[model samples]
Target chain A: MNQTIETMLNHRSVRKFKEENLSPEQIQMIVEAAQMASTSSFIQAYSIIGVTDPEKKKKLAKLAGGQDYVSESGHFFVFCADLYRHSLIGKWENADVDDSIMSMEKFMVSVIDASLAAQNAAVAAESMGLGICYIGGLRNNLPEVSELLETPEHVIPLFGLTVGVPDQKTAVKPRMPFQSIYHENSYRHQKDTVKQEMNEYNEAISAYYHERTAGKRSDKWTEQMAKMLQRKSRMYMKEFVEGKNFAKK
Target chain B: MNQTIETMLNHRSVRKFKEENLSPEQIQMIVEAAQMASTSSFIQAYSIIGVTDPEKKKKLAKLAGGQDYVSESGHFFVFCADLYRHSLIGKWENADVDDSIMSMEKFMVSVIDASLAAQNAAVAAESMGLGICYIGGLRNNLPEVSELLETPEHVIPLFGLTVGVPDQKTAVKPRMPFQSIYHENSYRHQKDTVKQEMNEYNEAISAYYHERTAGKRSDKWTEQMAKMLQRKSRMYMKEFVEGKNFAKK
Candidate 1:
């Protein structure tokens, strides 16, 4: 009975999916599971969009870094960092919610809420024999994703997920050492010894990548990260936040 | 077997804990489960600290917005949005990490990683007949919490959680309508209609609060939020982030 929790603990990104569809009942179960997650201040500041349309999925696939799995998966969902719900509450209360409360802090709350709920949904789907992969590449063309989705003001696409039966098996990605992340009481800057720990993890990650890509990229974790840093992400995000009149002031 | 997933689907906050101690093995199981959550790029940008010392718990209780559960729970853990680990990795790689990577995006990543891991811990703890209460109030005094924990640069306390065997029961909190939080394929602004749906939820929440708090406060969700927002939270968080050299341009 408790084994599911352990399964949740051992989650890994599944990039391959079999050709089968998730039943509507299963989709409803996952959505309800997600809805049950904690919302900040009872302000449910997030939303999920499920995509079962094949044509739409193909378009989204192109938008999200050309990943075919997104289009091929049994289900696709986009999590939104939302404030329009709160905006409605503001109008009901006849209160003026300025940029202050709606700023980055609020956006953060929405993002955290959405992300947590998404994780829960992921856990549930995995428990039900579904393989899942998060499509962070949705950020690469944020405006387009927003446009395609018909997202309104005070909402932004945080990420996408593809869920289906597993078509391929993958090794668990190695993580940085516990000492690197687990701090005692407060943060210590000098815990720089984590670098040594990650050195080992880097080798592990490198080998895994080599086997996965057949040596198309020998880049280790550090190298990939360095390359990723050069690319601009959500370049107009701050402006978009302001333009949508979401709180960043 | 399917009911186990329903059990996870039935999660709610647990505030009161029986006066019993948790075994170290049980604690380890939960914390290890938390540690296994996915970290962005394997950076593992978070930390959790267990606090079992009673006097220390009492002090933290005062710091955590006077939440008595802080001291009453069988176990307490402080989840931190930490980057000190990555800083160490940078040192080992002898790589200069630009401060820009520590922007709002990265900060959100750290916070989300910690939050998701905490949620997993919460779920795991619940599976084993444990009760839990998330302590967002920990952010009521971020610097003080950080100071008390000896958290160094590049790390910040995100929240705290108290887990134990249940001594008191808390009702399942009401959620917004499915349509309100779940969209089709993009963000939608349905302020007027969502507000109407929220009016019913406000009533339900009001009823829930009245029962829990003995009708000491009004039951309207909007009113409660208004009252809560009247107070300041994280007033200095931006400055704090800047002081930590996180928002450095």
Candidate 2:
């Protein structure tokens, strides 16, 4: 197999880390690698806040669904979809960059750009024999995170990533069948086959959960999702984001 | 430096790729790596269409703003933000994921999930000594791409990635100063020194462009962006995306 395929197939989330700080040079290298990613129209609408302070990490951990790994991790970075720089450029050019450009498409573009860059950094760390985990809980409190980062208009935190030296190894997570997600030529909205695949995936995930959770049968992916969706987790962040002057429409 | 970071830092678009066909196992590995990315609420709102057919690649190249690389690349995959899967799920459960669930927050989550996955696959390719380029031009004809891909409703083509062995080597692209994009707290917009950095970057890019374009001046990042933005790219894509059954209102 090609090296890329090998590395990708072997991916596993590393939550525990050795207690060691990353060198400044290493940080620069990783960030530079992230900067090399493709940006929409070269606007590069994203930013990464390298959080080094422990107290801040503690608070961040609390905000992010109480994930202790976030606070204890060696390097924590919050990636953001930032158009503030472009807005400043707009001010210089005296153009209205606020309204039309702040649509769903633009928002999605910036968020995706940031995530792509973060993933590159994650893979880079892993290739260096380091560990990484994506902290999606960062979105639990958008305004709080924005305030913590002192982010200005048109910039919102999308997610956080924790990187460090590995303290433990884990199994790579299994995914649903490709046919369930991949469509040929057009989308097929059938659920029987997908449901069957989900059931199998659920069993596999449940076994993994049991191995990790000390013989407890965890909720299936679907059940967990239904609960979270019904509970409307992080729903309040929507207004906070819009209130922060992003998503102008 | 770790191999992954080196790969990312050295990333340059490969417009030219060697003529080699990827094995089905390699393709599966890339897709699996993509699926492993963290999805918001575990909804997995993304899809990928791998295009290997020469005729389809040519048509895709033509549709994607005449980018010859699309046809020339050995492997091409279209990454999409797919809400259609969830729509089907909602139908099965006799429930609606609805407008509230499809908020900007949800949209951002799906886009990031898809992008992060794609980036992982890209890095995997790079680590394996392969070359890849992200094709943002895929958005140039969203409807056509959807039609060509047989994309169903609620799925939007976020971007395309072309991958293979490198047919030619390219110099690394220069980036804006770290300070310009990276902010301390909140955002400190409009700096006196940023202008100088911008000028430097412009000079660097212009030199690169000149070399690439046979002594012609390549406009600075901002200048190039201004020109691109003036074209009102993706102006009508908003309506088209929403029309495809994605809820915007």
Which residue ranges in model 1 land beyond 4 Å of their true spot? A199-235, B1-4, B206-218, B230-232, B247-249
**What are the candidates' individual DockQ scores?**
0.47, 0.46
Q: Candidate 2, residues B164-212: lDDT per residue as tens digits?
A: 8899988887777776655543455455555566677778888888888
Q: What TM-score against the true fold does each predicted structure earn?
A: 0.89, 0.89
Interface RMSD of each: 2.8, 2.9
Q: What tens-digit string does per-residue lDDT give for candidate 1 at B69-177?
A: 8889888998887766556545555566655356655666677788778877877888788888878777677777777888878877777888999987667776766
lDDT of each: 0.73, 0.73
Where does the lowest 10-residue lDDT sum fall in candidate 1 chain B?
B92-101
Residue A152's lDDT in candidate 1 = 80
Worst-scoring 10-residue span by lDDT in model 1 chain A: A183-192
How far off is residue A200 in model 1, in Å? Answer: 4.8
lDDT of 1 by residue, A1-249 (tens): 377676776678888888898887888888887887777766667889988778888988998879999998889999888877666556667666654355555666777788778877887888888888878778667778888888887777877878999898876665555555555444445543555566676797888888879998656776666554444454455555556665454
